[model samples]
Target: MGILQRAKPLSNIGAKQVGFTLIEMVTVILILGILVVGVSGFIIFGTRIFVESSSIDQVLSQSRFAVERMTRDIRNAVPNSVRLRTATGGSYQCIELLPIDSSTSYLELPIYPDDALVSGTVIDNGISINAGQYALVYPLASNSSGVNDVYQASRNKRFELQSSSSSANVLTLTFTGLAQFAEQSPIKRIYFASQPISYCFESPIGNSEVKLYRYADYGYIASQPAPSQMGTAVLMAENVSNNLLLEPAIKLTEQNLMRNAIVHIEPRFSVNGETFKYQHQVKVTNVP
Candidate 1:
């Protein structure tokens, strides 16, 4: 009787031990595998979207920097001295500001876009700041050939370099200066107004544009991008394109200041194929 009772309990236990058969176990594992695959796929798709979105944002930010820098220079444009105007295109960006400095008796830029004319060299008209500090951006050059063949320059010293059209191809602007500022005088500097560009991204559609205006009665602590002689360029933007629109407006003042610089820049592309458009208006100023 005891043996029969033990066998009966054993049988019951054996029956209850059927948690899952080999086939059932295989089925459960297959189901779990499917779930895992679906979850992983979802994660990968989400990650891809996030990466692409981030890339688009980055492009916009970089382009805005380029625009801000350009506009800031335009606003702080050196008056009738080193003026920036919208000619037919970039070709005439630095036209006849006449002389390189406030002192008027040095050179003559007879044409719209002046050319720097040395006896044997010709440089096209571009922007000119101070005498020793000026930039002449010419049009696209053809191989060894240059853009235009004549320009204008001036200095505090009374000397004018001119050449005829026959020698015009040889005519160009060249510069050299000599100055000995007062030493041990706290390294003094001239007061010049500055209009710096401040950049920001507002929306996904347009990420590279900003508001442009002048900051007159303000001044920049010019430092160096190169050495102590080369001043640091307060950069507002980078990654810019041809949508380079400039709308100039002036407010009532003793000297008409460029109140704002309005610009519309195109968007940047991303790996995931997204595009955006941006319009920016920036304030420019040269302050004390």
Candidate 2:
């Protein structure tokens, strides 16, 4: 049959071929739209979760790294690598290297955290411990508050020593190499504020919780009454919302004459509808 004849026969048929009505089309479109919306929501939710998790993870890692640096330096806090001696409360904490063998040794001096008082540790790195002067304090502030460090601190004069008793105390003192000396300058004393480390940490609260602190004797104290223990500030993590810093009690153990104790810094933090835990132990000592 011709093409026109075939079409005419089909057109003459009583029943028409099946096809989708407007209702069916609309229903299908509606179902697809719903599915799309659900999938989009899921994708957005997942993306948010991932971002928050990543942020939290980064924060946790940073905390660990910073603490590690602290512990490493703290362990070496000795007469040579570090100088630890009794100081009047509220005095500055110092860190410096004395050249026993070389002509000019570098002392990093009083360690200061990068941040401010509200969110920093008091532990500083620049002041040098005049190990020779720990026993005596000059201009004695009497009690504990009077003792402090008067380290050689002139930005331009890095090699110069504080002249409180520099000439009178050192009879055969030599800067180039270790020499015999009778009297070392006494650590300066003040009635308040030992050079404490101002440290910061987050509380178990929201994302912005941050605890402000100045702690040298394991806990943050407004006034360090003891002339022995001092503190400094170390900045750990920035943008910490909750102040979760713990006031830890420390003491010299009889068994461990090094006066060592470990503190497990187990903290729980929440981010993006999830809770995470961080646990680590920090070792500290109680040395007057």
Candidate 3:
């Protein structure tokens, strides 16, 4: 009877050890599927957010750098040298300026007396000047009494350095047109180390994929040219917005009076189906 009792308990335990039924197995599989789908969705969402944030950061950095570079250049432009141009229907688009590389005092007046006869001018001994460099000569003192007056309109004269005499501290200058300075005038030299720089928007195919270009070596004339020629276009920024009405514009104050320029830049970038925009207003003061 003991043996038979033990055998009956073992048989009951075996019956209780049955594997999972179809309903139970299907329920577990459904729960696993739900967890997998949820985890996958979270991963995808995180990746998308990371990508979008990176894109935004890249656009912001590029736009900020470009604006700051242009602002610095414009602020240091020579007095009364900032020129602005607009497209048809008064859309502001282009700006050109003469950049002042360095300024130094003239040791004395030119050895010669006549403007036409003078070919070389003397400056301070330490001033560094090179051949092919441009110079703007003006009076050091605003109230000085001489042939070279301090008035903004009358004093400044542009000349190209044909050669330099480092030992004698003289710059041999040549005039593109006529020499503007007389020989016995008190003057200072504002060297033009860089060529005339111009910033403008150019579209490759009728306003498609418009890009910002920086042109250099386009001749320097006091008056702004109509449809200014762009020489050696360098890409400043890409993927510029197409709205002509919202492009970069320059508002120049009376050059002879304030010598100020206000630059408005609204750069828009489209990245990963998202649009990013940056707007900056830079007030540039021309210091000759």
TM-scores, all models, native as reference: 0.37, 0.42, 0.68
RMSD of each: 16.2, 13.6, 7.4
Better of 1 and 3 by TM-score: 3
Q: Which stretches of candidate 2 lie over 4 Å from their true place?
A: 1-20, 79-208, 211-235, 239-270, 273-288
Error of 2 at 252 (Å): 9.4
Q: Write the per-residue lDDT of candidate 2 for residues 225-244, one digit (tens) a residue.
A: 33223335444544333223
Clashing pairs in 3: none
Report how far residue 224 has shifted in candidate 3, in Å: 4.9
Name model 1 segments beyond 4 Å from true. 1-19, 80-151, 154-271, 280-288
User: Whose lDDT is greatest here?
Assistant: 3
Residue 283 C-alpha lDDT in model 2: 48
State, as a TM-score between 0 and 1, how close model 1 is to the true structure: 0.37
